[model samples]
Target: MTDTDSLVADLRFAEPDNPYLRDPGTSFHPVDELDPETAREQAAVLRDAVREHDARYYTDADPLVSDAVYDTLFERLQTLEETFDLDREGSPTRRVGGETLDELDTVAHVTRMLSIQQSVDADEVREFDDRVHREVGDVSYVCEPKFDGLSVEVVYVDGVYTRAATRGDGDEGEDVTEQVRTIRSIPERLAGDPPGFLAVRGEVYVPRPAFREHNRERVERGEEPFANPRNLAAGTLRQLDVSAVADRPLDCYFYDVLGWRATAPATAEPFSEVEDDDSRPDTQRAETAALDRFGLRTVDRSEHVGEIDGALDYRDRLLDDREELDYEIDGVVIKVDDRAAREELGATSRAIRWAFAYKFPARREVTRVTDVVVQVGRTGRLTPVALLDPVDVGGVTVARASLHNPEQIAELGVGVGDRVRVKRAGDVIPQVTEVVDDGDDGHFEFPDTCPVCDSPAERDGPVAFCTGGLSCDAQVARTIQHYASRGGLDIEGLGEERVEQLREAGLLDNLPDLYRLPERRGALAGLGGWGETSADNLIAEVRASREPPLPEFLAGLGIHEVGEATARNLAREFGDFETFRSATVDELVAVDDVGETVARTIREFLDNPDNAAVIDELLGFVDPESVETDDDGDALAGLTFVFTGSLSEPRRVASDLVERHGGSATGSVSGNTDYLVAGENPGQSKRDDADSEDVPVVDEDGFADVLAERGVDWPPAE
Candidate 1:
């Protein structure tokens, strides 16, 4: 049998000690009946069993047990770990993911992650091949499907998973260690002998089937579906809540090694010192094989080709079969097979000389525009949508496409009865690319008034907005949903579906109408899918939010350019709602991080008579507390501090302390920064940035000394 066949055969059977291999009649002890010793032993056994199962399912594609059975075993293990307090550092239970991060930290890559040169023209690809042949005569090439997803650098130390980061700017990336740990396909520990240190570059993506199902569920729940799998994957990896990422169906395929170091048992010589060692992979094909042996999942469709023509044929076949695959691929990557050949070819500053990405033509279809409609978002921005004669583009039947705004509409000259060529931008959002044929109707004229509320529409640069504020029915539904979102008051049971139901029933018309729901509890309980218990719980949650934090209240208003961070800055600067509302444009611009545009937007929102009336009505039911201030002094004023690595306290706490002392703390180092407070094992990227920006680098103790010199106590009294 071939090596691959043998591996597959072995994966079909379970080890004798595996919990699932036990006799069907044999009953397991319940959690309540197990002693500490028994629970500990079972936990270890379960961890091993689950790891083996994950290998079979994710890597080998041969699962011995059904998903239901696997879930049962996983839940039992989690229960044991939590009940016995036997959780270890690398427990499989970590996959469930409950950890939350204040922000994504910045880290330096062990080596630069370069991009591949790409072109949609076949001639460009042939030129690349000619150059490669000139440098390294007659070298074979390895071809792989170029995944349309986010690129990440995953690192391992001593055969155990260490950390992961995004491929931001090639040299620096945002740390996503906890988020990446939740992907089951990525093994926490290497299967065989691994190098002392390894950093592999890979793409993380969501399967197309899962993406469709996720979008379907979102639409059913009255939530906006994500544009495409790539956007979803990127957003998921950057999420601060690990649990949210864990709930999503994310997978990864490792492609290239960015860094490697040999250790004892593998080799005594380090990777940098070993030039011709057989222990290290000599070719791209062998490197993929080595990654597979180390329990890393590599692309299955990769192949070795003798010449560029064969690579082109492979790309053609992949493009034809793209729709059949579970993941999205926009092009095919061709790389020099031999490592020596690649070194001889060398590389440019931005991309490698021995590799090229031949892209496919974008999927597009020509269809007629039947009508045009306007959509008003929660923030009052107006969007123009084109109703199209249904056409199939990239396997999706798109009946509507976004015209974006009036400027785009005028540029395309698109109107009713016009033939337009539609393309799914990024293989997700359908948009009109150009007018194929002008119709009898010359061009579509945008409305001068809001279609839903008849409010005067005004243009802000390229985009337009409704002056209706909360009066528009379309805007009110979305506004209420945003008001109760996690970034807002965080009231439970105020999801999109619930808000729609309340609106359709004429029970809610404005922001203050939500607080008035308590008086209409009897009517709410009578609605479909809601009983007395659910209604009362929702009412209680609403009542509980009558008095919210100033920042949250500000953010919940759906004000333009006012997100969580900006709201916090505004709250800290003004202290109270009355002061913040009355602040002038100049005063708002004086706040940290608030630019002229954002300051003007905030002022415009508060100065509007309609918005003021809503605020006055809301104030009757809601009382936002004044933000606490440091009355002692602003000794650290006019200074900006950036932090990296593990400090004496959490980074957010340190940042809050800085803000409390009238100083600004940012996430990245720049020329505006005054000091970089680097704790133990601080990121090398921040240090490099500090050097480049000529900013001072100080340890935690030095920071404390600086604070002490300002008459502020370090490690503030508990």
Candidate 2:
């Protein structure tokens, strides 16, 4: 078999007969260079590509190509169609999504949920602004985040949540009311005096923290983590079992009020087609405010810009802060603020003319892979990690990236000293997306023995595992570190350095040794850099960690398939350690998110006599506490805010204020930073970074204004 054929076979997927993908490098031939017949043939190829990608993205929730590649194909299709005058009926270009999944019940939308025209260039955004001005002079715009997630229409009657459906197509969608209801942020009942009948359109998303936790768990379990939170959220919502949906940490943020009806005023009109002033929202800002008033989550970052320049500025800021947000957003939705202006501007057959989706530039970066090294995880899984010539991906320096496995290495067709494309999207781990250089032919040798212990290594599916369990020093260190990690048991001050010290002293071997450290206080105190006071404090911290929340304890166990999110889900389902420990494969599989593969993994772990003994020993040293799932209302949760320069108060005071509001304040500016609070003489580098990343910089007063909105005091507590 050819290399591509071998890679395809290794992927365990049946390759589709795609015409456009015959040679991805030659997929697009300039329309101007091609004859009419050739152009038509190319158009046909592009049509197939678009249809295939749409199916992969919408129905399967697993897009085979990157958004950039898909967009390129779509643009080519549009060009060919225009050039050849080959516009076909029911073209994929005119549609919003793929065919509805058979597993989901279909529901026709009350009013069509049309898509927005997308543009990556700033010039296009400027043109859109100029066009709007030409059509309806000097109009204001409400710029909001164009969330990258599954779009859903939520319906309510008599202030009670009634139904919700996914945006499968423009006119119809898949009914996912039961699954959507499980999202805690989405209210079962509307707040205030809501309209008698209301329809709100929103994006169902996985928060960045939840997405990070989920992916981290997947990595620890020797599984390929999800590419992006948006895909995972969509896939979760489409699950056949509602219980599976509930297990996923999902949140919804309403963007548009599609329809509202009030009995007293007798006002009833769909927002999209409202004719009268009374029935229509005066401006986009008013509609968003109404959504917030009715107890729906609206984008707080949304701002009203007077003209095109302000809209562009907002767009830049959003790009800068893209990584800082908990949810994924592809672009800024720039809409004419005035309802009358929007009505006058009108819409196209597929999208609104009054608004445009100004998409952010693709985040992928191409860099040379200097070398490839094998890293052994706590679970004894060997993963090939790529060490790259430092590359800035989406405004972040990514030096090291995951190769996933030997199969992925083969599939990417890359080797050391080769130029490769790396992608950093949201909080997902930096990944080598593709091999760019053709000169390199040699691939990394998949080892037959463990790098650390020289133990026999065996491949299970795509993953290679070392036979040395606790005997492997690398595994032992990683396991100890995992136990002390933030999402695990969270033992204070027990970082890599301390874990290494303990390991070298022969005081640690397994999880139970952590709890027993206090008994050897004198031995710990005698160690270099350790004193009586420090030893006592360490012991106290270790003892305090005995009754960690059940989920954390489960995560600390380093189960093959159990990560923090899965552990939390399992903990929630089973209630306690006893139930989880005694769970059979059937019981485990019955739990939401715990499919047959995971169920078998868990059952096999528990069935092991050695693992059972370790668990029994650990149980005697520690008590598992019930998990407290509810986070106190954190107004600024998922926002990475930075306080720069000098503030009215001390920098610490301002930083503390941010923390109190549930937002993090970093000293440095990066792609992940959402807001930069700049005081007088703010660092030039920070300003430059903000400008480069498109992060918004606000004055000290502006920072205070945001705090006021969150109901937080300007001067935080000492």
Candidate 3:
């Protein structure tokens, strides 16, 4: 941990003591009292800048700050190593843990998590349970609640449920066992005989009346709500559509069991050791009474506590009579009741010598910008958006946000009487990065076209598009609300709240009248959580979405610059719907990575004659079925490939497995990629874009040994 103490703990910092910090001490931290040469150069520049910004915020989903400024520079490098004694044993305070994800398959944890120390109030959880009863004196407690959600771990084996993970820097994670086998209180088998390889660890929420009925059905289907309820319970448990996270009602609670070898011949190391006759767990008295005798669900022991004035009188009775909590605690955890003075007061790589979290005070909002509209997405970009005035911050409400392009509306020059500065951004949605004020009557007027189809608004690089594809009715009602979305075409009772009650009851004006709504099936089974078998199961899910898939019927025909991976690479290389409606824009720029702005937006959406009479009356009610293969013969036909890592399918099924042989699927590795496949962990900037485009690599078992050396029969390996 040297090299001139990682260049003086990369010039350490940590300033905010408090001031409505909208990003103060901008992720503060650095007061741990230092001096062994500034705690060995601030633990070698905070363990090499928090492991390269935790690998650019969680394995490169790219973040650099905004987890409220990486938890205020991880609590000012935990208060400059707790008031400058700078405890550097290679500190991020001795790393919690990570590094497994080769598309997830590493498990190793025969017990060693130990990291939960916190403090925000109740006199720092009573000076951390009075320095753990002044280091092991008279103890016996356990309190738990701190669940804002998403810290799983699970395991089980003999008692059944098999795997769940994601406490990342606590040990390895991201192996969401096929999205925790679609959650339903996670049981896959254990009713009793379990304890064999049983790991346990808890949390995975959403509740708060299912996060305000899933953000009021994503703002009545104009789609995009979630910046709370722990990012829709961490994007519905990382969905890559495990049946869309088994129709979302996800919930789990557990608490803390960790590798239960049939309850240690029932404890003798005394609840695992701190001393006062240190050796107890033979009967379970708390880690929420040994994870509530193995069945889970434990954060409600009347907000558990043993006193810090009864956990600040149960956190001021949850901000006075439970701040309408149906879910979402954001504070009150308080632990350490002698498991031998919490193991003679151990831990500090990230948290816990005896527990403390009391925390709850920075969700922010100051709203004002009354008008800044622009919108238009579906790849016709144009964002800008704003419109605020509402407010509420953490308890949710936020009127409207997203100044994401127009270079964040001229780098946050957010006009219309400014005084803006919202948050939520990567917490879920709301954005407006900043525009506090510029006087000169806080400017505005940015338009340059398409106020719903006045056409021409093009930019790109800090985005702005709107060449008004197929006549924009607000980008065709946000692409038919992402084509009756729930991730495209889930159709059921059509949303955006019944497409604005069928556009103010003039009875919906598009997407072939949302499939002949049988004249609104008794007003969608009399709406309001709809009934009568949910309106005959929403006209049998809109007649099973007139049998979709031709890449979800060309992503529900919102076409113009088509996306959904370019409508599944134009439905796996034009094999139907009249060869992609008689291809042209130079025959989709002669296919391999079609471009010229997606072949002039697939030749202006097949030269719209009212979208080719709604694609020939929706191909006379659906059936463009052509599962590739005539990709005209073999050796990867007209070659051109790309893909990078973690692909056992998805990157639009590896561009329909390179247009199923007659290759053509590009998204980066350039110089006309004729093969760059590479798999598993790949990304040193996509192996330097396939070594400066000499592209060759391969793997998914070397594209099945180049499809059995071209005799092509590769489907048997799954």
Candidate 4:
């Protein structure tokens, strides 16, 4: 028996149900009852587990356990540590996050980046509002979505972008200016000019659509997808290869100008040393508005309310529409609109006193586990999935949830017909949190063999992996499907089922064979599902895909750790397939976003004798295009403008004018926005956001004047 089998053999259970999950009311009782030495030992085990989970969740973007399970381990460790006086430095409880990677230089923040106090209960929020009123009179509040992402401080001097750092340890952070600059939303130069020195703090996150595309590509490549967008964004930022940063679809939403100093040119010393007569925004709303006028993006939706009831109502509304947003937000942040009120309320040693993060309750539901089945992932990891009876979780119907692995299965002691609790983990993935009751049905027995390929699935740590690689029919079908999927080569009429049929017919063995489909056209036409027309169409698509631009070609290969963004960056860097194919590991790693792991994977795949021969053969049949510049090289190439409401022409026409002249047209008002072209009945919220940020708004005629100044014709020559 393997170590995994031995571990499973030792699972302990209570008389009726899984004892592994302790009672919520008294979860730490087992440790509390143990002797001091044993308690310390248990504490150690919990600590290591927490660290491992953190690494998986934060760094690897693949969490081995559910949030509920990790929470239990964390809470238990905290209890044991306090009981035995083991709460010291380096304890998991003391740190905000896992260790910062040494890929970037460390820099001390001008001012500490503090976290706000959080409350899940509405009553607590009310209490906080009451306390704020008692301390500093009745005040209006600015409430916005609390973005789920990495926080960074962006610095500018004399209106020029200079420094960007991560929120590491609050007081100090990693200097990721090189990586941060690659984010399109973050302006390289602040628009409205003229701040002697300023620092704006905001969240950097990957939007949902981009995150979904990234994971889809990962699954196609037979790799584990990231657990959440927040983790993926954070991991991407920390990558050593600056080129790697280019491929990731990242966005920044500025929330606060941490500090700013306005000074004359003659007396231009550091803001910290020479601050004397500069005036700053008097309110949080004003500051965020200033950021918007300065051409920086802010939260898509925010509210300014006069009463506590209004704030609470906004929070409720956000909870209802949370999943609808393009990015993740755990809750809404309510802050005193008046800067004076915030200062008067003061702060605790750790958190701001005037601001509160009204977090939503964890989205959970109760359901019955009908059965347990092993899912063979792209990487061949055998994950046990709880086949749940159809149940509503949050707003969606969940029929299945991940069990993580055998250890989690044993820990839950969940059997078929068992009642279990499930949570919409991060409001995205459904996960089994606990077994509520073990029914008369017996416990689930993990299969010893791979369900897909019938190979011996060997247990290693928490994952049971199938020994089969590309030989597995399921794996091959998935890979080929990935190669033809929308985000890949985008071959029409070739879905997973069709790919499976092709693979089974012995016409397709590897990705390279995809180009040779025309050779098997007669045979394909004679197959059960195919006719001459369909065969010809398939061959046409296969032929058309042979000349995919560099990025699409790289993405189609489904290389490990390489997604759409990474592929795009790589394509741009190498210019041609031959150059990328001949690049060394060091050369690859030196590219912006490519880290050591990704570099090694790329090198190994390309350097392999078999893989190289296949690549060489494919190159003969394909032509890879060079990366083209995103801008049209017009006068306004770097400027971003938003056209609102109705214009003389359609919104698309107006936007096209901007894009044609080398400017970007966006939907929302932000600090980094260069202009807002307003027409009849423009969105009040956009106008309000523009006004707050001091963003300049123009009528159609005024817009024409601005465009004319840029040497663009009012209407292109017809």
State each model's CA lDDT, in order: 0.82, 0.73, 0.60, 0.73
- On residues 348-424, what C-alpha lDDT tens digit does candidate 3 reach at each position? 77666766677665436875664566656545676666655456666777767877667556656668657677888
The residue pairs that clash in candidate 1, if any, are none
lDDT of 1 by residue, 473-541 (tens): 667877888889976889999998899899877788888899889999999999999999999999999
**TM-scores, one per candidate:** 0.54, 0.43, 0.33, 0.43
Q: How many steric overlaps are in each model, in order?
A: 0, 4, 43, 24
Q: State residue 581's C-alpha deviation in candidate 4, in Å.
A: 29
TM-score of 1: 0.54
Model 1 poorest ten-residue lDDT run: 268-277
- Order candidates by TM-score, high to low: 1, 2, 4, 3
What does candidate 4's lDDT look like per residue over 1-718, in tens digits?
Answer: 9844643342221112223332223246676468988887676655555544554443334555677877777788777877788854435564322243456888877677888989899899999999998888889999999988999998877766667899998878988877887675665445454467778898999887687667545543344566567888999889876666767878778888777778533543232343423478898888877776665667758999999899999999998886558787888999899988887987777788989999977544886675576777766677877765456788786767888899888888888878899998899989999888888888888888767666666777788866554445446666677778765778998897787688768788877788888988888998897999999999999999878867778877767668765776677567788889888989899875699878977876676555566667778888887653353358888888887878877565566556656676766889989888899988899889899889999988998899888888765555
Best by lDDT: 1
Error of 4 at 143 (Å): 0.3
**Which parts of model 1 are misplaced by more than 4 Å?**
1-16, 21-27, 264-278, 366-718
lDDT of 3 at 122: 58
Query: Global lDDT for candidate 2?
Result: 0.73
Q: After aligning candidate 2 to the native by TM-score, how far in Å is the CA of 95 from where it should be?
A: 32
